[model samples]
Target: MSRLNRSRSFLWLAGTVGVTLLGSLIPLTTNNRFYYYDDTQAGAFGIWFEIGTKLSAGEWPLFSDTAWGAGNYAAEGQWGIWNPLVLLIGWLASTSPNIVVFSTVLKITCLCVLAAGTFLLAGSYKARPEWAAIAGVAVTLTGFTVYIDAASWVTGLMVFSLLPLAWFGLRRMAFAGGNPILALVAAYVLITIGYVHGTLMLAVLFLGLFAEAWLTARSRNVMFRLLLAGMVCGFIALAVYLPGVLTAPVTARTGGIANSGFLTPDLTGLATVWVPGSLPQITGWWGGFAPVPLLYVAWFLPVLAIVDYGRMWAGGKELAAIGVFGLLSLGLTLAPSDLGPLRFPIRLMPYVSLALLLGAAVLLSRYRVAVLSRGRLAVTAAIVISGLYLAWSQYPSIRMAAAFGLLSVAGIGGLYFLLFSPRAAPRLKSPAATAAGVILVSLVVAAGQHAAFKASPLPDYRMPDTPQAYSRQLPGAEGGTFVVGDPTKLGSQIWNETLASNAWYLNSAQVQNLYSPIMFAKYAEDLCITSHGWTCSSAGRKLFETDPATGKVLADLLSLDTVQILRDPAATSDDIFRDGPPAGWHESSRSADAVVWMRDRPLLNTGQVVWASDGTRLSLVSENSQEVVLRVDGLDGGSGKAVLSRLAWPGYSAQGASLAAPLRGYLVELDIPANSVGKSITLRFEPPAWPAVVGSIIIAIVVSLGWSLGELVLLRRRRPDKAWADRAMAEPVKAVSPQ
Candidate 1:
C-alpha cells in the first residue's frame, strides 16, 4: 500500500479504538459496582455463561432439560453457537474471574467492531478516511447503540455491529468488481449471528445495494452475480433458522404481527437527531420518554452545508444508495410495534443513524469545497435554528440544555470549517492537520454525549459481590430446582438476592426458571408460566399432585430436588408451605428474602430417566444434555412406559423403544413393548431436520466457492492484456475514490 493509504488505515484503527474507549468511560465510571443491567444481567450473561461452560467442556449443547422452558438451544436460535466469534467470546468469558468485567470488555470490543465497520462502509462510498472515521465515531456512540443495545440487548448489539461490514462487502462486489468471496463470507457471518432483526436489515441492505447497482452500472453480469450471491445467503439463512422453523408450532414464539406501541418512536423524535443530549418523545423502556437521545445520529450532521448537492445528485451513486437505505430504515423505524417475529421499531434506529451519517460522509467527500458560500451559510444557520426549536418543542423542559447543545454543534462546525476551508492559515490546511481536527472534534462530541446521558438506567438497590455469587448462595440440586417468584416486583434485587430469571443457569442448577424468547408452549401453560419464566402463585401447589402413571408426585416426576419461593408483598397467608412441607419434602432453609424447600428422599437415579411405569424398570447408564443411555430390565411380556425428565422438544428419538405420546403433556415418554427386556436403549435429541439443514449449508458453501473460482479465472485472463489494463485505469471509479 502507498504511504497515504497506510496512514489512513492506521488513523481509522486508532481513532475507532480511542473514541470507543473515551465515549464508554462515563457509564463505566458512574456504575463501577456493575456495568451490566436489565436484560443483560438477568438473561444474556447467564445464558452465555452456560453456553460457554458447555462448549469449554467439549460439549455441543443443543438441548438442556436443566434450563426447562429454554432448553432447546438450537431451536431458540439466538445462542449464536454457529458463529466462531461468539464461541471465542463465550469460551474466554467462561474462565474469567469477574463476569461483570468480562462482559464490560466484551461490550467495549463490540463498540470497536461497530466503529471499524462503519469506517470501512463509508470508505467503500469513496469518503475520505477522516470523514469516514468521524462517521464511525458518531454512529458508534448513538444513543440506541450505547444505552439500549449495549446496556441490555447484547445479542442485538453483536448482530448490529456487523451490519456495516456486510454492507461494505455487498457494495464492493456489486459496484467495484471486487472478489465475491468476501461478500459471501460477510453475509454468512452476519446471518449466523442468529439475531432475526439483523438478518432482516441485511435483506433490506442487499435490496438497496442491488437496486443502486442496477440503476447506475446497468451491468447484467454484476446483477446476475449479486442475485446469485443473495440466493446463496438465503440458503445459509435457512440453515440457521431451520430448527426454529420446525419447532415453531410448539414454541411460544409462534405469532403474527401485532403492534403494542411499546418502544415505538414518535415522528417528532427525528427533530432531536442533531441535539446531543436532548431526550426524544418516545415510548421507551423507561416509559413516556427516553432518558437518552435514542434518535441522535451526529451533532455535525447539520454542518455539511458546504457540500455541492447538485453535483452530487448528478454523479453520486453512493449517495443515492445511502438515501434509499435511509428511507427504508426510517419507514421500518416508524412501522408497527411488532412486524412478524421482530418487535420494537426503535431497534432499527442504529441502522437509520448509520445510513444518515454515511450519506453525510459521501456527500462531503464528493463535493465539500474549501470555502462556505453566503447562501450555504444562510442555509446552515436556518437548519441549526430549526433543529433547536423542534427539540425545544418536543421537550419543553430542557430548553436550556437544547440551546447549549446547538451552540456546541456550531462551535465544532466553526472549528472544522476553519481548519479545512480557505479562510484558515496554509499550515492548518494540510491533510494531517485536518484529519487531527476531525478526530478531536468527533471524540469531544462523543464524550459530551456520554456525559449527558449519565449512567445506564440501572437500579442502585442491588450489587453483585462476585461472578460466582449466585452459585455460592444457592445450593446445587442433583434433581432440578424450581424458583417461584415475580422478577418484575423484585426489580434489580433479582440479580443478587434470589434465584430468579436466568440466575439458576449461573449456579449450574437445573431450575424451572428460564430466560428465552422461545419456550415450550405446553410446559409453560401447564405451570401457568410467563415468557420471562415467572410462574403463577399456585404453581407450587400444582407440583404436589401425584402422577397417575407412576404414582410419583409431580415434583418427583419432574426430578425436582429444590424449591425456592421469594418473599414479597404478594405472599399470602395460605402459601404453599404454610401448612408445612408435604409428604417426602422438608423445609431446608429460610431467610428474610426467600424460603428454600428440599426433597427428603431425593430420587435414587438422578439421571435422564426419572420415572418408569409399574411393568417397566430402567437403570441409568450415562447421560448428557443431548443424549441418555439406559438399561431396561423388567418389561417382560407387557407394554409399559418410561418417562425422561426432558422437555418434549420435537427432535428426540429412541433406538430400542417407540416414541410414546408426551407424558402429562411435557416430559419425553418412551413406550417399552412386550419383548423389551434386559436391552440397552439410547435416546438422542438432534435438531429435527438436521439432514436438510446441513445440506443447505454445504450447498451454499459449494456454490459460493464455485462462483469465486470462476471470477478468479476471468480476472487472471483479463490481467494479461494491455488494453484491459488501460481501460480499467481510465474507467471512472464507481465505488471508491482514486485518492
Candidate 2:
C-alpha cells in the first residue's frame, strides 16, 4: 500500500512536469523562440542581455553610457536589478548574451515549477491525487498564464511558482503546525514581489492571505503567529524592495489613470478566462476569444466551489476562511478600476483563477467520488451538450466552435472513463486511473491552448545573431553618442534598429537608436522631444525619428555629433534627402543599409574639466555585473569641473577628485584641482541601498531574521521529541479509501 502511494505521488509530480513541457513545445520549438514584439521582449530585454554581458565581465551591472537615454540615471529598477532570478540568469548568461535561449529556458522552467508547486500544495491540503494534479493544470494553463508565459514579461510567470509555494507554507502552519519550508517560501515570494508588477499584485495577494489568516485562525494566538509571519515577510521584502519603491514614483508611470472607473473588465471577457487572444483593443490580445465558454473551463470548479463554500460556512470555519480569501481576491480585481494605485485590471485574474481552481480541488478530494448513476450520467451529458451549443452560439466562427465542441466531448468522456469505469472485470477501484485522467486533461488543454495562443498573428519580428552592422562611423566617437534611424516604426523588423545599434556598440561606439531602455521620466521625455519633435508618450520609451531642426537640437543636448539613417522613407523625410545633409552637418558616407553624416566638432567630451575647453580624454576602463569604471586622462591643469558622460546618481566615486553633486539633473560632474592635471582618474558606480539608507533596511532585516529564528527555536523546543515538518507535511492526511 505504501509503495503504491509512493508511486502515485511520483507520477503526479512527473505528470505536472510532462504537462508543462507539452504546453511549451510550440513556443519553445518555434523559430521565434522568444517573442520580441514591442519593447518588452526585444528592446528592453535586449538591453538586459547586454547587461548580462557586463555581469560576465564581473562589472557592477547598473549604469551605462551606451544606453539610458545616452547617459543619465543608473540603469534604474524597472527591469529588476536585485531579483534573485534576474541575478541568477544574469550570472549564467553573462558570458553568453543569448536572450532567446535564456528566456525560453526560464519560461519552461517556471511553468514546471508552477505545476509542481501547485501539485504539492494541493497534496498538503489532502486533495486526491487526480484532483490535485488537475488543480496544477488549472493553475498553469489559465488565461493569464497563456498570455504572459514565454512573452517578454516572463518574470510574472515566476510568481505562479512562488504563490503556490507560499500558500503551501501558510497552509501547513495554519492546519498542521509550524515548519521551515513555509516561512522560507513565504519569504521568497515577498522578496520576488518586485520582479513582477512592481510588487503591487503580489502585495495585494499577501493582504488577501492575511485576511484569510485572521478569519480562519484556530485560536487568537495562532492568529498572532500568522500576523507575525506576515510582518516578518514584509520586513524582509521592504529591506530588499525599498530601492525600487523609492525610485518608481519618479518614472513616467507615476500618474494614476484618469476616469479609471471605466476600466471594468467585460463580463463576457471575464467568463472566457480559459480563452486567449481577445481583441487587442478589448482584451488586449489580437486573437479572437476562446471557442468554449469560460466557465466551462472549470466545470468541476464551480460545482466544487459551492460545495466547499457550504462546508466551510456550516461546519468548518477554518475551511470557510479559505472561501472568504477567494472572495476577497475576486473582489480585489474590482478595486483596480476604482482604486487609483493599480494599473491593469487583468492583473488580478491569476489570483481569482487560483482561488476558483483550488476551492474546487479541495471539495473534490474531501467528498465522495461521484458514482455513474443513470441520472448523474444523463445530467453530465446534458451539461456537456449544452456547453457545446453555447460555444457555437457565442463564437463568430462556427468551425472553431465545432472543433472545440469535439475536443470537449472527448475530454469529458476520457475523464469519465478514468474516474468511473473499469473496462475489464470490475474491481472496487484503480488508483492508476487518476494518472490516466491527468494525461487526458493535459493533452486536451495543451492542444487547445496552443491553438488559442496562435489564434492571433504574431508580430513579424526576426533577427539573426551577429545581425547586420553598418560599416561607417558616426562623428561622435569621442563623446561616444550618435543617432541611428530605421524606416519601420515600433513594429516587426524592429531589429534593423537594434542590429545597427549593436554594430555601433561592438565597434566601440554608442547610438541614440529608436530602441529605449526602461528610462527615467525626464530622460524619456527628452528622448521623445528629440526624436519626434512634438509627439509625447507616457510610456517609458520614445521613438528616434526627428525633424531636421529637432535632430540638431537633440544632438547638441545628448552630446551627439553623428546621425545615421537606414535608407528608408518613413525615417528620412524628403526635405533632407531631396537636398542634402541639414545645416551644421555634412554627409560622410552612404551604403545600402546605412548613411552616415558628421558634425565638424565634438559635443561635450565625457571628461571635460570646467565643462569645456580642457583636452581631456575618457575611456571605458572595466565593467561587469556589479560595477562600471571610466578612465580620465590629461586634464592639463585646473581646479575646474570634470564633467563625465555617465548619469549622476548618489553612488559614484572617483580616484582623483572628490565626488560632488550632479552638474545638471542629468550628467555627472566632479570638482578637481589644478594639481590633479596629468594624473589619471577612474570613476566608479556604487549606489547605496536607498530604501534602507538610514539603516532601517538593516534593522528590519535583522529583526525579521531574528524573529524567524526565534520562532524556529521555539517550535523545536516545544516539540523536542518529534519532527513538526514530518507531521505537518510529510504525513499529509492520506486519501480516504473508497467505501
Candidate 3:
C-alpha cells in the first residue's frame, strides 16, 4: 500500500481494536452490583425482573403489587409491562436458573451493540478509525457514564451510546440513498425500544433531524422522507416497547418520581447540577495517574468545528445540529434538578464531541494548509485555556491534567496533519489494502485496552443485598396499606439517599407506612432545607413530613423515623447512617441485615397477614407450575419476625419471614430453572479491584501504546505511495463511504 493507504489502514486497525477494547471495558469491568442510584435502574431492572418472571410462566406483562407495594408516594403505581426488548432479554435469561450468567451475558450484549453502533457512527463520518476508537473509549470512561452503568442505570448510558450511530446511519440512508430507509427504520425502532434514557437522546435526535431538514430545504423531500421513515420506525420501536412506556408513569410515580420545580425554561437553568462543587475533581484532574487524560487536547477540534461552521450555513443542517447540542449541554449543566439529568447528561457529551470533531475534520479536509495555521494555533490555545478552567474548577488530579496535556498534543498532531501536511503521502491504490489497515489498528487498540483493564480493574465496592437477597419479611398493618419506596437513591453512593433505610422500614413491617403524597412533597422540600443545613431541629423534622391536606404535621405524628428524616430533618439519612452498627435493633435469622426493634411498640394484637407469593411454581415445565397467592389469616400490631417455615414447598427454601405488626409477610421470589435439574448454579458478583479513575489511566496507556506500535509496523510495511492514494477514494459513486 502507498503511504496514505498505509496510514489509513493502520488507523483503521487501531480503531477496531480500540472499539472492541472500549466495548469490553464498558461492560466487563463495570461494577456488577444491581439496581442502584436512579429511578432508571429501579424502573428498568425491576421491570426486567418482573417481565422475566412473567415470561417464564408464559404470561403477559402486568403490573405487580409486589413491585409497587413498597411505595405509597405515587398516585398510580405498577410494573404492569415494560419495553419489549428489555423484556425479551429478561425472558431469555429467565430460561436459565443462573441469573449471574444471564445478567452478565445480557450486559455484554448491550455493550457490544453500543460498540457496534459507535463504530458505524464513526465510520459514517469517515473519521480515522483510531480517533473514532479512542473517542469511543473516552465516552465509556466518562465519570457520570461509568457511574450510571455500574449502578445498573441500563437506559441511562446504553441508550445514549446508540443515538449518534443511529443518526449517522440515518444520514447515510438519507443523503447517500443506499438502503437509507432500512437504516432509518432500524434506528427509530431501537430508539423506541423503551430504553428509558433514550428519551433524552430522542430529544437530541429530533432537534438535529429538524435542523437538518430545515437547513437543507432544497432537499426537503429527501429529508422529509427520511424523517417520515424515522417516525415510522420510531413507532415500530415504540410498539416493541409499548408495554414499558405505558406503565412507566405508574412506576415512576410509585418508584423514582422526582418533581423538579423549575419547569419554565428560564427557571430550568437553576435546576442543573453543574455547580463547581458537583464536578468530579479527582478523576477529572489526574485521570487516575494514567498516561492519557479523559479530557483530550484534541477536543479543541470541537471548538474549531463550531467556529468553522459559524458562518458557513449553506443550509443549516450542520450548524443547527451543533447549535442545538451546545444549548442542550448548557441547559443541562445549569440546571440542578433532583434527577441529576443535567449533570448526568455528560453521558451524551460524546455525541456533541463527535459532531464538533467531525465538523472540524471535514472542514479542515477542504482547507489549505497556510490558511489553517493561524486558525489552528488560536483554536489550540483556546482549548488549553478552557481545559485548564475545567480542570481547576473540577479539581481533577495532576495525572488527569497531564493526560489532557498529552491528548491535547496528540490532537495538535492531528491538526498538524490537516494544516501542514495535507498530502504527505499518496492515497491507497487498493480497497483491500485500506481495509486491511483499518482492521489492524482496530485489533491493536482492542487488545491493548483489554490488557490494561484486566491489569487495573475498578476497586471492589460491595453493595448490600437488602430487598433482593435479604429480609424476606416485612410488616403490613391490618387494615393498613404499605408502600414500597424509590430504590433509585443508592445510585449516587451518597449517604442521604441510600435505599437501606427504606428497605429496612419495609422489611421491619412495623406500623404500616402510609402512602403519603405529602411525605414525597416533604421529601422534596426537605431536600433543599437539608442541603442548606437549615433544618435540624425536632420541629424541623416534624415540619418536613407535614400534610397539606389535613393541616397535620405528621413527621412527629408517625411512630417511625429514619435517620434521614430526623434531627437534621433536611439531611439525607446517609449523613449519620453511612455504614454503622445497628442501633436499637436486634438481628433475625430469616433476614440478611434484618433488624428488630429493641423496644417494641404497643400492639393491638399483631397485624394480620394478608398476601404471600413464594415464586415457587412461576416457571415452565414444572407439573405444578401454578401461580398461587396465600392470605395470612390474622395478627395485628405486633412487630416481630413471623416465619411460615411450615409452608415450605418444592422449588423454595423455608427462609421467609415478615415483621409482626401491619401484617408483614415474606416473599420467596424463585428463579426459573433451565431444566428439571441443571448443573451446579453459580451466582457471581465480583466488582472491579481498581477505582474508575485508576482504571481509566490504564486504558489510556494501552490505547496510546497499542496505537503507536501498530502504526510503526504499518509504516514500515507501507505499500508504494502512488498505489495507495488511488484506493483511498476508489469507492464506486454508488457506495456510501463510511463517515
Candidate 4:
C-alpha cells in the first residue's frame, strides 16, 4: 500500500472507532444517565474512587481498615492498582466533579479501544478496511459485551477490549515477520489487569494463535518468539497474581466446579444469534431471561447467506484456524457453570462473538459476490424466520420476536444493497461508502437496543449519588464505622435519599459496608459478615462480646468509634438497643434510616495492636495501611504475644518480633522474644516474593522493549533494498484469514 493509501486507511479506521464510541454512549445519552447498575455502582466505582483518593493523598492503598474483611486490596487483585492506566483512571474519576460521568467516559474510551483493535485485527487478516470497520462496530455493540460487561463489569470490559490488539500483535509477529514488541506489550498489559477470567481468556487466545502459527508456518523462529512472549507474560502474571494466590486460602474464593446452570447459554439460543433484542432463556442475575441481546453478534451476520462460501474455503489455512478457535470458544461457553477458578461461562461470550465477527469480515472481504439473487434473499428470510421461531419457542414473546425479526431483515437488506446491489451508483459500492452504511446501521441498532435496555425492568437502573452527597449524609468517624444490617435491605436504600449502600468507599467515613468478592473467612465469620461486608442482625451482639484470646470486645479490637444499625420499623424489638446500650456505648442519634451508637472512650492506641500479653506493653508510634511502628516495653524478661486487628494475610513481617500463630487463627499475632522486647518494632506488609516478582517484571519489560526495538532497526536497515522489498511482497501471504 502507498503512503497515501495508508493514511486513508488510518483515517477510515479512526472514523469507525469514533462511530463505535458514539454508538456505545447511546445508553448514557438516550437515558440521560450513566451506566450505574449493580456491580458498576456498588463495586467498581467505589473501588476506583478509593484508589484515587488514597493515591492522591500519597498513600498506597494496599490495605484498608475501613473495608474490614475486604481490606487487602492487593490480595483481591481485581482492584488493578498495579496497572498504571487503571491507576490513572481511578485517580481521574476520584478527582472528577461527577464520578458517574467519568465512569461513563472511561467505559466509552474502552469501547473505542475495542473498536480500533478489532478493526486492526481484521485488516491484518487482509480484510478490506470497510469490512474491518463493519466487524469492529458489530463486535463493539455485541449483546453480552455492551449490556453485561460494559454496563456492569468494567474490569471485564477493560480486559475484553484488549484481546483484539493482542491478537493483531501476535499475528503480525508469527506470520508477517513484524516485530514482536507489540505482542509482548499487549500481552503484558492484558495480564496486568488482574481479572482471572480475562487472564484465562488471554491464555486461550495465546494457545490458539500459537497453534495456528505452528500448523501453518512451522517456522522455528516464529515458534521461539511466540514462546518467548508467552514466557514474559507468565512472569508478569506472577507479579500480578502471586499475592492473590497466596491469600486465597484465607479468603472466601475457594474454587469449585458445579452445573447449577447459572450464566450457561442454551444451544438453542444460537438460532436467534442475529436478533438484536431477543431475550433468550438464559439464567443470569436478572433471573430467567437476559433483558439485553445476550446472543446478538451483529445485525449484518445473517448477510453471510449471500457470501461465496467456496471462495472462503479456498482462502486458506487461517480460516480453518479461526473456525477451530470459534468452536473451542463455543465449547467453553457451553461448559459448566463453574470451570475451576473461572466462573460464569457467559463471560466467554465476547470471545465467541469476536470469532464469529472476524470470520464474517474475512469471508466478506475476500470474496466479492454477485448481486443478491432471489434465492439468496429467500434463504435470508428463512433464516430470520427460523431464528424468530426458535427464540419465541423459549421466550414466547411474539411482539419482541417480531420486532427483532423485522429489524434483522431490514438490516440484511440494507447491507446487501450496500455491498452487492448492481443498481446502486458506483461510489455506493466503494469501501468508504460501504463502511459508512455499516456504521450508520450499526449506530441505529445500538441506539434502539440501548432504548430497549433502558426500558427493561429487569435491571435496577438506580443511579448512585455523588461522592459529596455520601460524605454530607455520613459524617467522618474518628475511628472506623461498623455497619450492622442486611446488605440486601441496605442496598435497596441507595436511591432512597440515604447513605446505606455497599458503596461505603465513597464517603469520608470509614464505613464497613464495602463490597468484595473475596473476604477473609475468619474475619467474615467472627463478625457475622458476608462477602459484601454486610453483617447479620446478630452482628450487633457479636461486636460487644469479648474475645477470649485478646480479652477485648470486638468493637475495641476493630477500633470502631461509631455503629449504625439499620432501623427496621416492623421488628417487634431492637436487638442491641433492646437491652439498653452495652457498657461504654450510648445512642448518639436515630433516624428513619439508621440508629447510630457512639463509643464513650476510644482506644488510645489507634494502631493494630488491640491487646497484649501480661508484662508486655505496646504504644502506637506510627501507622499506615502497609506499615506500622510501635514502641515496646516490659517484654525484656519474658516472651509475650500481641494480637493485631489486622487480618493475617500472607505478607506481614515484624523486625523485632516474630510472627506467632494467628490469634483465633485470623488476627495477626506478634510474638515478642526476650532478646528483642525493648527494641522498637517496625512491621511492614508486601506481597510475598516481592523482590523476585518485581525484578522479573522489570527485566521482562526492558528486555522485550530492547529486543523489539532492535528488530525494528534491523528491519528498517533491510527495507531500503529493492530486492528485499520485492522478496517481501512476493512471499506467499501465509497470514491467517478469519474463519
For each candidate, how many residue pairs have backbone atoms clashing (under 3 Å)? 0, 12, 90, 1
- For model 2, residues 598-704, the per-residue Cα lDDT tens digits are 66765543333324324545455665322445455555544545555455544557777676665445556666656654565666665456435325445545655
Q: Model 1, range 493-565, lDDT digits (tens) per residue?
A: 5555465566556775667788878878888887778866878767888888887877878887777888877
Give one digit per residue, the lDDT tens place, for model 4 in 1-739.
5666556777867887888877877777666444555677767877787788889989776776546677777778888766877788778878878756777788888889998888888777767777788888888888888777877778888888988888887777767667777778777777777878778877787778777776677888778878878887888888888888887888877778888888899888877788777778888767888767888888777777877677666655666557767888889899999765567898889989999998888777766466567887898888877877887887787777676667777777777877666688998877788888877777787777776676322344364547666665445355777777753553455333334334667766666667778888877887877765667788888888888776788788777788877644445565663555778877776666667787788653444788888878888788977788888867744878888777787888999888988876777888887755557888888877778767878878887888888887798665423232122222212332322
lDDT of 2 at 730: 32
What lDDT score belongs to each candidate, Candidate 1 first? 0.74, 0.50, 0.37, 0.74
- The candidate that wins on TM-score is 4
Candidate 3 residue-wise lDDT, 318-432, digit = tens = 4455467656744553333335222233344444444544444333322213344455567656655555555444545565445444544454454445334547444431333
Q: Largest lDDT belongs to which candidate?
A: 4
As for candidate 4, its clashing pairs are 359-739
Write down the TM-score for model 3: 0.52
Residue pair clashes in candidate 1: none
Error of 1 at 453 (Å): 2.7
Please give the range of 10 consecutive residues that has the lowest summed lDDT in model 2: 532-541
**How does candidate 1 score on lDDT?**
0.74
The TM-score of candidate 1 is: 0.89
